[model samples]
Target: MAKITYVNADGDSTIIDVANGDSVMRGAVLNGVKGIVAQCGGGASCGTCHVYVDPENTKPLADMHRVEDELLYFTACERKENSRLSCQLPVSEELDGLVVHLPEKQL
Candidate 1:
């Protein structure tokens, strides 16, 4: 399992053990971590699962796809260079220390 930390806008954080091969959004939703709406349920259609990856350690994460890159533009919060759609980021051992911050809100 990979240790994935989810930090809300207020700075409150939750650490969840996400199984390898699972998307970050799935880990958050299954464990009841607040903040991610996942409106499209991993379909990458809704921007509700948008998150900012840990800038310090994003090298292990997957490259953004056409769909996710476009969806980030529609997120409730303004997009950042580290912005990513959680559903598109599949967890792996290399991402054990991944930290993702939840936007202020997911509409």
Candidate 2:
């Protein structure tokens, strides 16, 4: 399992373990990690799972794809250079220490 850290807007953080092949959003939802709504259930269309990947850890994440890119435009919070949909980030052993920052809202 890969360990991922999720930091909320209020600065509270939780670390969850995710199995390989599972998306970051899945780990959060299953663990009850606050901040990621994941209303579309990992489908990439909802933008509800939007997160700001810690800049230092992004190298291990998948590159932004068209679907995520377009949906980001509809996020409920301000988009940043590190903005990404957690559902699009698959867990892997290489990403064991991945850290992502949750946006203020996901609607």
Q: TM-score for each prediction?
A: 0.96, 0.96
Model 2: lDDT to the true structure: 0.92
User: What are the per-residue Cα lDDT tens digits for candidate 1 across 8-104?
Assistant: 9999999999999999999999999999999889999999999998778754778889999998898999999999999999998888989999999
Off by over 4 Å in 1: none
Error of 2 at 87 (Å): 0.2
Q: Over all chains combined, what TM-score does candidate 1 have?
A: 0.96
Worst 10 residues of 2 by lDDT: 55-64
Which lDDT tens digits does candidate 2 get at residues 5-87?
99999999999999999999999999999898998899988999999999887457788899899999999999888999999
Off by over 4 Å in 2: none
